[model samples]
Target: MIESISKASAVSGTKATESFSSLFEAPAATLEGTGATALNGETFMSALGNVAMQAANNLKRGEEVSFDGLTGKANTREVVDAVMQAEQSLQTAIAFRDKIVNAYLEITKMQI
Candidate 1:
């Protein structure tokens, strides 16, 4: 009886292993369909232009508030808010630029 049980257990283990192996094997047709989109220069430049425009807008608003005065023309809080927004926008733009430069340098160092 012990021998019979051992044989049954081995058969079940073999079946389980076969099923697990099939789970990872991709169909040939599925593999053929998988592809990657390539990034190009236009997309990169457009994204950079967007960030610069946003930063410029923020600074322009801050300047407008400062020039118009905080009396009745503009609320004291509005001027302060504009200035803070401009500062944050500029800082974010600078950080993003640094990150992109670092990535470019790292990629250039990689082997083909």
Candidate 2:
């Protein structure tokens, strides 16, 4: 799922130079209590959910492949591919979740 993000600036006449760190940092808080924003929580969760679902579906396909007989409705390559895809998707989702949780914990430790 693509999240629509819009950016605007009021630079006078020069180009702007920004680093990648700017993308990850949360906005500074102010007096109005409106600056504590989540860092792509919805998008990240959506992506993680999608990958997990795909992994589960792939595993089901692998099981189906086995049940369908190796010569009738499925082949060895198909089963192998399905299993590999499921494994890779599961690994990726785990890694992403770990990274996000680690980032949140690190931010919580900041001297703010």
Candidate 3:
């Protein structure tokens, strides 16, 4: 899956600078509550929800493709590609969730 991702990214040359760490980064918090300033917790949860939804959608698509392939209505290549993409998306979403959970755990450990 990693090899396929690297190959795809190399061909596109559009996602070169984005590392895995950046995917889980919490966006900058505003100094004061004002226009365009979303609560940091809300923003993080929104991001997490978006990524999870995407991963779920990918998996659903992959499952559909697999079923189609079984029925001889879709190409095997489509199934393989969809499943691979779903796998990568799921891994990414899981990693993001783990990072958020770990950060929360660390914060809870801090003494007042």
For each candidate, what is the lDDT? 0.67, 0.55, 0.67
Q: Which candidate do you rate higher for lDDT, 1 or 2?
A: 1
lDDT of 3 by residue, 1-112 (tens): 2344234334323453244434544455442333455454464434655666667778778878888999999998998999899889878877986987898799899999
Task: Output the lDDT of residue 93, model 3.
Answer: 71
Clashing pairs in 3: none
Report RMSD (Å) for each prediction in the order shown.
Answer: 25.2, 14.3, 13.5
Residue range 23-97, candidate 1, lDDT tens digits: 545555555588633244233444555677777778777878877764469888888999899889879978997
Q: Mind sharing the TM-score for model 3?
A: 0.61
Q: Model 3's lDDT to the true fold?
A: 0.67
TM-score of each: 0.56, 0.48, 0.61
List, residue by residue over 1-112, the lDDT tens digit for candidate 2: 1111111122212333233233444444431277455544443334444565665666566667766756678777777777677668657767977987898899999997
Positional deviation of residue 63's Cα in model 2 after best superposition, in angstroms: 3.3
Poorly placed runs, candidate 3 (over 4 Å):
1-42
Worst 10 residues of 3 by lDDT: 4-13
Which residue runs of candidate 2 sit more than 4 Å off their true CA positions? 1-45, 69-72
Q: Count the backbone clashes (under 3 Å) in each candidate.
A: 0, 0, 0
| Local error of candidate 1 at residue 12 (angstroms) | 66
